[model samples]
Target: MIKIPFIVSARAGKLLGRENFSNPEGAIIELVKNSYDADAKSCLVVFDIVFKIEKDEDGIDKKILNNDLSNIYIIDNGEGMSKDVIENQWMKIGTGNKETEFISKDKRVKTGAKGIGRFALDRLGFKAEMWTVSNDNNGFNWKMDWKQFDNSDKSISEITADLSDNDINIAEFLKTNFNHIKINNLFNEVSFNTGTVLKISNLKDDWFEKDIAGVFKSLEALIPPKELNMSFEVNFQHLQKPKEFGKVETAFFNDYDYKLTAKYDAEKLSVDFVITRNEMDIDVIKKKFSELYKNTKAPYDLKTLENKVFKYSKSINELLELEVDENNNKLLKDLGSFDLTFYYLKYNVSLKEGYPFKSISQKERRNVLDKFGGVKIYRDSFRVRPYGDTDNDWLKLGARVAQSPAGAGQRIGDWRVRPEQTAGIITISRKNNPDLIDKSDRSALQENDSYEIFKNIIIKVVKEFEVDRSKILNVFFKHFKILNEKLRENEIQRRAEDLVNKIIEERKVVEEKLYGKKYNSVDLFQQKRDEEERKKYEEAFKDTFKAIDDEKIEKDNEEIVQIRGLASLGLIVSSFAHELKEIKNNFDDINDLENIYTDLVSNESKKKIEYNDGINIIKSLKLDTEKIIHWVDYSLTAVKKDKRKRGNLNFIKYFDSLSQEWKNVLKNRNIELVIKKDTKAKYLFRAFEMDMNTIFSNLISNSIDSLDMQIKPAILVKQHF
Candidate 1:
């Protein structure tokens, strides 16, 4: 049979370049990644745009004339390629060189694998020129006209690019052609004998001031934060907008209200998380905090640190149908470790008062969020695409907020945080998580088991941030509301007192004129004054009582809301308990059959079943199942439906039930729990049983925590009549 040869047309360049890149920003970023893979310490991006200065209300503004005089230049001090290397590797499409040698000489993970990154030049402009010098001091000039590839009849091999050896002055070239003031200083600061310079003309897109600013913002976060020991740096310069030029640093808010960090450990199947409130914000809230009602106080608890192991939590284990080892450890061995950091800002009109952080205006804060919000994923210190983009709700936070809007089942003035209110970074690496692969289009991580687990874990951590932030914000809003109400009341009382005094003086003057000296008679005047004073005292008492009553009603409403929230949680627990009972029953049936089979096999083989591997496996499974069933029973007993209802709860019976329920747990911990009766009289109270459970649960849990360090620990519940 005759072998058929595959043919590729020159037009294929369009598919790889223009069609592949969703935007000019992405195309430029791809080229920058190439520079990074070359182990470059610094990369400079210049937007050469022709513009005329125009005066506006905000002073001088650059008006971009047109794209006719726009050119883009990207320069990097990297290990420049030789002629042979350029032709064999850079010139070839879909090269596998990077795939084979995935690490650079400096031990940096190669960011480009597909090797079509060179086509990014075509995506940016119609014509491109390059100048490069290798370590041997040998220079080369390369030029390509992308318009030549538009011809459908031309074969890929026929369309040739110009590449030739030439001696080039790197510094002189920039001064002679660009004629920019910063060029001389930049070349002086960055000393390099070997590097690459790419110039693109006949621009594909107009380079306006706004466009340049957008690109600069993206470049700011293109690499990991400097604190991560990322040696590389990026700089941006717009020739027309010289004032906007600066070194790109990671864009983050230094005055964020809350910062949360979560680190996962794959070996332990656990995540350690820390949530910290900004000290300045906490201080401001504390200062503003007032007794809105009698004896009311703010939730002053600020941050939390928890090392949560993945274990018997059905909500977590059910996520992956996870397998447990003999020691009851989840076998999520494939899910690799990752670190996530998030910063949150509670932006509301109420927060305007006592805003203790940097005095960022509302407009400025919103602009910052609009520019640098959303959670982005970084791999090998480079950001992946589309995940943290302004409109890309990869975490689906917006949808979650929509499902449970403010006041759905939460405290008053508490709302779910919107996607724009947070900025975050999730760091991952190929060496750690090989399964989380990127798609060819560089859109996002491929939809796979590892990726799903990764997103779920991040969402879970973010939930912690949201919950704590809500609590603090709720307090702030309530205090603000109370302050406003107090001010209004004070103003009304002042006006009322003024009006009453005016009317009383006017009546006294009229009475003096009508009745003469009789009106001034001691007995008659004294009786009238005494009556007026008595009436005023009664009115004052009524107003004061009304204010107190209003405060009491408000306090009661808040308590009712908290109780309802607990009831909501109890509802969830009850539902899970039902499902757990079903699961336990099914497992018990399986265990019984396994036991019977083990007995039969032992009899048939004329040996004990304990020596057989199959019997041992069954026995281990049964033990785990029994443990799970016990956990289910404990939960079901703690969250009985009747506990969530309001009624006359007998403290004696309640304490007795709690002692019985906790007897096994306390026994296992080598601790004793006792309920002491102080009197023979019945002790009862009107309350939601769940509220009592919550109060006692907190007390008991705290006692257990402290008991861990005690040699002998006991919990006593005293019942008084």
Candidate 2:
């Protein structure tokens, strides 16, 4: 057995001035909450401001002014209350109907709690009336005067309503005053039905002062409900349909989608985001935003708050989209959808709670919200603002407003609106929205856990896109092969360069030993020898050494140049392999030139030809003269020598090889490569196979290094000669 404890309060502290609304906005929100608790599918709020002439104490005729008259009506189709319920629940103060065991037929419990919600009506109008009809019992009608509650001298009887109203004129007046409440004067009606209506009158003059219509417009646009499916109108004209805040128009490289939408309201700033499925690989969105808004300081210096907001908003799709398994099947039989909306409002620091009335601590306020502010998240939408308490830092200070009510909170757990209750809320508040434009949460940008998750998702998507395992494996093999080939080429180039340098040094030593005595002797015997003989010998020696040094330098330079060229070629080959593997693991037909190069490199062929013989042979060939001409032209091009003095053979080769290996890895991962080159060139001098290989490897490795990781993983290589 259990007993309920009863508490009592003195009547002196019971009633106060009707205008204890604190603010007009809060008063309106209370009314809206009531409609929602009643399970109203749609609620409409209309503001009406009526003007009349009144006389002052001096008997001077003065017109009492009004802003608007048609805006003071709030209509809903929820379950209307009976006359008795209206008197006890609607008119009476401190009566707890929400605690009663009144459950709807659908088994859905009510959301309203505090008995003081009706008291919020005091902010709207001076005089008020309520008309309702229930179908479960005999039909009845009733109305209450707000002015009566404020009149301390008036007895309770005067404030109470009489259900007996049968006069035709009185009925007409009631009908005119309460259009939302349907009733006939001929018979009393009272029954609990499926629909309910509420009409309020005697709107406060200040109700129209804050632009009620504008507020509704903003609310409708900002928070479009999917469950209740709301519609709003000004006067008789319906409001325009709300548009999505962010939409991706262009697909970026790597199939990453980018979307951005921004709104600026004096001191309030907001940005919406959407990223492509794969684009989540990198956490660059926050970086990009920081760069964009770096010039402006964070409104409240609330780094944590800003970060939470950005992260939550950016990953909205993840919350709404269904999860899929490796087989591309939905993980859950039923999926949930979510819609998030962020609001930012700015107010004076002095208005905030816990701070001095004359001076408020902006840092403290921001810190408080960053710690705990705005609405908590649920699965589909926010629970509502101020879920835990009204002591939020930002809200207390009147700085900002954020409403996201998803997550573990009970206030927003309405199954009718959110069928799958697996959502969370993230609300952030700042001193001024404009501050966000300048200040950023550097900590959020540094965090990489979320990025790791995003990368895994991208990898999964890539795997799904590539269904043919054989093709994927082929690409892997081809990439590996190209990488190995590039590594070999790089080694050959390094060896060639070293050998060229050694050969040049040896040649220099031989030349110096051979001509050293002859040159010295000639200088000494210049007067004794024949003039023509001396001149001819000197000229010949000078020309011979110059040509030798030039050849040596050119060979060394060729080794480096060729290595770079080969690296580029290797990258192209890897890309081609990736493409071929992706398209059924079949390679494109090799061109005759490519085949010739492959055979030349693979096979040892030592065919010596004089300069004249080579020229004659090219002329004799009838096949495409252009090809031969191009080959000859390329052969004439000069090669550049290595400029760096340090010679770390292993390091150079290792770096070149690593570059090629990375390219191969990318190809294995399903990347593509393309290559373009000028006509092939012939070598005039004999060169080692190692040298050629090294040149090819270095060139290809460099090209592979330039490939972008985010793009379709493709590389393009172009060679001049």
Candidate 3:
């Protein structure tokens, strides 16, 4: 066999760094993740922007000069690398050391899997320097000019970085080099023997206040949920505006209207949903959730409802490949158990200081949602990218709601959830769900059977939350509507009072000007005239209010009339449908009439030939009559009084009847409908029969509609009963 070496171009480094990170914020986050993997208890990000201020056309000073001199410092009090490590793992491109040693010395799971995270520094700046002190107190300074990597003529192996050993004092180093005093003082306070400091200069992007704020917000999300108690801290400081940036804190969970905790059990093939109604804002709820799970570590409060447990449906379990192995142990093929905590809120923009809005202002709550309002996924106490991003709608919730908008009512499927209205975290670990792996770029989970099942289960849990929340929110909406109307009326009354006062003041001014301070019969006459004027104005004000009330009453009456009309129309339609069904039952002799015509045609030989075509036409017409009868029967069944009432129902039997009802319809379309029961047990459930019909009919209809262009279309309804 002939061996030929594959030449790696120097440009590969640039591709790995700039191409991997879409923005500077993402590149900075990668470095922070690296710090976490180093077992860092605290990481500090300082944006030391050196710029000259220039007055704009509006005479406002702006930092738009010398932005190229901006420097970013990312310092971490972690286990810094030694010389050997720098030469081997740190120097090597795409090193597998992290893959082999996935856990840190502190027993923290390594967050950075792709060894190329170091390249993030290159993405941020053309030149970079690293000052690191190892556990042995031996310090090393490494420098790299990333611009050299752009030389396409040179191979990656030919390029080299500079590394030198040095004696470093943490305090002395900051005093000598660090220009940002606040950040410098912070590092001096934290005593650490082993740590790494990255001073990146010759920046690629101009650092502005907004850009720095974005970085700060990203850092806030970088911290794992407090329930994990990871004890890691990240501080952000801007030299230009030091007060605005500080310790990265999470968005307030106490502001949530509803908290839903959902957990799936792999062994039991069951899912549990616990919903807690937070009278928080109701009482300005501010406490965090407290109970900690065995696998997923988070402490949440135990203000919970009676847990609702649902077993996996037959089809869902089949997709999961639930089975018993040869050793008599249960086995789940692709899917593992996962838990999700979701917080939902309905924003009130014009909130005033009161019971539900005391702790936080409306603006503050809106800002929080603007920053962190989407569902995010965390793996091994670290977040996965692009899943919960503002632009990333992995749940397709927006699309779902766009297709069928949610309304302010308590109806199944009517109150669809929106992406912005919720914030949540889904925690998964590599040990439990090895199949659900991230792609090399760490953008999202690999789209496989496991991922599909995972997304479906999450959406299912969210839907359950939506159903319960709709009932509560509708009442709130109605109360708000009434409150708003009362407030409007009060505003009108206040305006009326202001108008009457203004008129009285004008009359007094005119009277004072005309009647020249004469105390006598003239004063009395003026007083009498003023009293009459006051009474006339008061009467006009009352008349205006009366007119407003009359208009409101008229509108209310119109709405009542419309509702009654709709109810009467529905009764008429139901009556007609029943009468049509009765007529079809009594018209059974139509088939007998067809038989008589057939006999008449068959008796005369000459007429039989001419009537043969007519007879076939009559038969086809008879088939059309059968279709009409089927539709009428189905319509009559729908309006039955028993179906409208709620009771326990066998879902499997219901499906069987539903299938029979649609049997002829499907046959005409040449589509097959199959219902398979995995067990003999009755899947009894309490619900209105009409509700069940609505749910399944819509599902089946949508399924059939989508299959219009597919070949050999069929629907298989599988039940685990």
Candidate 4:
């Protein structure tokens, strides 16, 4: 954790010498608290003008009028302060009256804490004087001259002393116990009983530059009475109250009241309207509603019921009978219910006393009238405008509804009612403006365009609400749809597995028919006889060759050698015949073996076996076949007694043909083959071409078998010189 150091000293001077106010209105508020503390029912502030004339050096007079300064005096008939309180509480700069036991009866209602309100006079002027009489009939008079404490050397001691006879008497009464004062001077006199008079002179004239009306209007709105019993007065006069303007009439309507009401679930919004009998003439109601609901076409046969009033008392009944006809056919049908009511209001006009009628100006009256401009909505005849006109954002109707349970008052039409259900006593005036009426009519001439904006907003909100509900339903349906699709897919997968099993069974039978049996006795016997004959032929050939080369002592021994060679040739021929017979038998055996292996490999049961098992079988079969081929080649070579030779071969042609044949073999196995030769070279004599061919053939065959087991097989054959 990071520890934050608290710098007590750094913040100590933050509020010191600060004005404790941002505007003149704040200072005035402090003064009001002082009056309340004094227990005064009413306090009046007076601004008095005192002029001083100065003469130029040329002896011509010049008027030196200071608008920045004014003499402010506050008079109240309340329990006054005594000499001790004036010195210790009133005149003291930092004395805390709130902490004193005798100063206030209610601790919660006290506004003063530092008792520094007296310093406010210091900002306006250079001096202050307090005069008062105690409520106990004890006279006390006092004067505090801040100039005496001021560092400036300016003084009016000479002027004040010349009037000492009058000033002294008033000062004695304020500073000590005295019944009355006999001062005859303008500045020295006791004016009231058990009250305090505070005079602040040499006020900064800039304080008078503010718009007093504007400030007062805002204060009135912010501080509305909760019980609707308190009335506020500004500049010693009451504010002009709101008044109803006029009743708009249409054609001759029914003598019964009509109501309209609606409720929305998503927004939790509810709206109700109460209309009185003849409150709206037929023509006016239709015209206004047409503008409000322009998107809705006129109902057919609506003229017959144009001046009629709906009679249903309950919302449910009204919804059942509700219908709109257009073009001689019913165009609108309702599915829900609504409630509404109506009434007429009388209007009276009043204005501020000194305000001019024609030249009053918008700035002077705008703040006062704007507070009551909006239509007041009510739930139970109590005002619900939060903070009155101070809150301009009229949205949050749902929020107000939520708060209604907390016992908040509702606004009844244009009146603000109390929680006790008492009506507000503030009387307002309503003045009709014929010019405004004419303007409204002229602007409404464009019937379609005039209502287009409002119509769009209503339609947008309604559609948005519907769309939200539809989205919820769509999500619900989508879940079930996905579940159904999953079920269908599972069924398909199961069928695919069954079909695959059936295919394997059928393939096994077909493979058995194509290939023969394995481990036949006939094949083993023939292979063993071939191997024995090959060995015998090799032994006989060697013996004959040894006799012919016993002693090539003389060149003439050729005849004997020839005889030996011929005898050897005869034995070789006999051996060759036997070998040929054996070769034929071995060939038959090999054919049987190939058939058995092919049958086993191509069987459906084998196809279903794992890849590793199939590869092991192929490897074993290849080893056995290679052994058999080697034995046959050895037997043939011994009988023929042929020597190994080498010959040049076109490697390109060989590889090309080999690749073509390999491709054809791979096609049967569903494998692809590619063979490449680079810089083919002729070989020196070493191994015979036939032996090489046999070796390569076995290797290629084994490679092909290995590739056949793969899903997509590819074989690459390459030869380098």
Q: Could you give candidate 2's per-residue lDDT for residues 411-516 as a string of tens digits? A: 2221011111111133221222112111121112122333233223332222221222222123223444566667655654555455555654575578689887
- What lDDT is obtained when candidate 3 is compared to the true structure? 0.73
Residues 112-197 of candidate 3: C-alpha lDDT, one tens digit per residue: 66678878988888889999998999999999998889999999998889999987965568667767667767767776678899
By lDDT: ranked, best first: 3, 1, 4, 2
Q: What's the true lDDT of residue 341 in model 4?
A: 20
Report lDDT (Cα) of residue 479, candidate 1: 64
Query: Best lDDT goes to which candidate?
Result: 3
Best by TM-score: 1
Off by over 4 Å in 2: 1-20, 50-64, 67-71, 100-103, 107-109, 153-159, 165-197, 217-224, 227-383, 386-721
Model 1 scores a TM of 0.60
**Model 2: worst 10 consecutive residues (lDDT sum):** 414-423
- As a TM-score, model 4 comes out at 0.29
**TM-score for every candidate vs. truth?**
0.60, 0.32, 0.58, 0.29
User: lDDT of model 2 at residue 240?
Assistant: 20
Better structure of 1 and 2 per lDDT: 1
Q: Rank the candidates by TM-score, best first.
A: 1, 3, 2, 4
